[model samples]
Target: MPALIVPTTRLHTAWLEAHDEWGPGSHEDGFGLRPSDEVDSPAGFAAWVARLGRESGQATIEAHRVHCTYRWIVEGDQVLGGIALRHGFNDFVQAAGHVGYGIRPSARRRGLATWALGRILDEARKHGMDQVLIVCAADNIASAKTIERHGGVPEGIRDTHLGPARRYWIKIGRTAT
Candidate 1:
């Protein structure tokens, strides 16, 4: 089975390779973008990752280290996609979740999202999140289905800074692993 690999400094080359494949318009590319445009390289990503680790403790943003960033790599070699898990509060309840994921465009419709999210949900439980709030765009039917498949229960939908988002909650022990 494919496993979730945490991103690390040693995998910078892999990250670079994936970034090149996905390019700037992809959601994965958004992770590399910053306000100052200074974070534009491997070294910059490493620094940014380190900074996010530090900031996660002080700020409400629970963005974890890449080691904590879960990925679904087939045969443990091909990185299909991943979920960026960041801890959250009230705002996150309405918009963001503890996790955000995307499959490579070429790898879509292959059940990677369901697998990746199932793994991330396990990680959330390991991190002491008894209940997780997962939100996706109301219009994102695919994502909604993935969420539902993973046992997410519709809590409500709300408007946020980005747009309309549907919020779902999963109680860790309620579902069998």
Candidate 2:
């Protein structure tokens, strides 16, 4: 079974494999990758991973930044995908949502995204979030469906820096069906 795990240097090679499959782009959402991040070299990857942990450790929101928990989806030693659970809302979170996830192309049809989202929703609840905003590309049918399956209520489509996105809200602190 696939499990959510904290980002680790041990999975560097496996993580790179998944990263390469997405080709070259910052479009690999959920990994919290930025255009300026250099994850190619081992040292660079370690630094990037450290940054992720530091972001999560920031108890207080700073300026535009918010605490965010990052998790990798792994079954055994293979890195299949990643998910992010943002602790609070900000201008960026308003467009991106509190939860973002992506499964590698090879792992897309295995319900990994759905599974990861479910896991992160629990994390959000633990962090005292009453609800979470999740946004996906408006044209992404699979992501929309996955959200809906988890009791997400449609909040309509909105334009973001990344273009048109479908927004959803999932309530926490309640018994899940």
Candidate 3:
């Protein structure tokens, strides 16, 4: 079974390979793709991984930044995908949501996203949050369906710097599916 693990260098190569195959990942909420040059070297990549892990675990963040936890969806030794769970909502988080995830292109259409998201929702519940928002690109039918399956109540589309996005609010532990 695939489980969510904290970002670690052990999965860096596998994660990098997956990202290379998929090209730049979904730039949801300013977590843009890593630069190609940086990902080219092992040391650089390891530092990058360490930085992201540290950034998320910070007890205090700048006003513009928020605490988030980065997790990898791994099945045994392979890193299949990732997710970011924001600690709380700011103006940016309000539009983006508490949870954002991406499955490698090769892993798409195999029910992985739905499963991984379900796991993330369980984590969110543990945080004692009443609700969380999840947003997807407006035309992303697959993502919309995944969110709906997790009890995502449509909050309508909103304009973003990238483009229009579909947003939904999920009440914790509701088990709509």
Q: Top TM-score: which candidate number?
A: 2
Candidate 3, lDDT over the whole model: 0.74
For all candidates, the clash counts are 1, 0, 0
**CA RMSD per model (angstroms):** 4.7, 2.8, 3.9
Better of 1 and 3 by TM-score: 3
lDDT of 2 at 159: 84
Q: Which stretches of candidate 2 lie over 4 Å from their true place?
A: 54-63, 174-177
Per-model C-alpha lDDT, please?
0.63, 0.85, 0.74
lDDT (10s digit) by residue, model 1, range 1-177 = 666664455555555566567776555611323454344576776765564443332222333322334343443456566576554445443356766777766777988888878877876776666777788888989999998998899988888777898989878753434
lDDT of 3 by residue, 109-138 (tens): 988889888877877777776789998999
Question: TM-score of model 2 relative to the true fold?
Answer: 0.92
Question: Which runs of model 3 end up more than 4 angstroms from their true locations?
Answer: 24-37, 54-63, 173-177
TM, every model: 0.73, 0.92, 0.84
Q: What lDDT score is found at residue 84 in candidate 3? A: 72
Candidate 2 lDDT tens digits, 1-177? 999988888899999999999887547777877777788899999888888884453222344587788898999999999898887678868878888899999999899999899998988877778899999999999999999999999999988777899999999884454
Best by lDDT: 2
Model 2 residue pairs with clashes: none
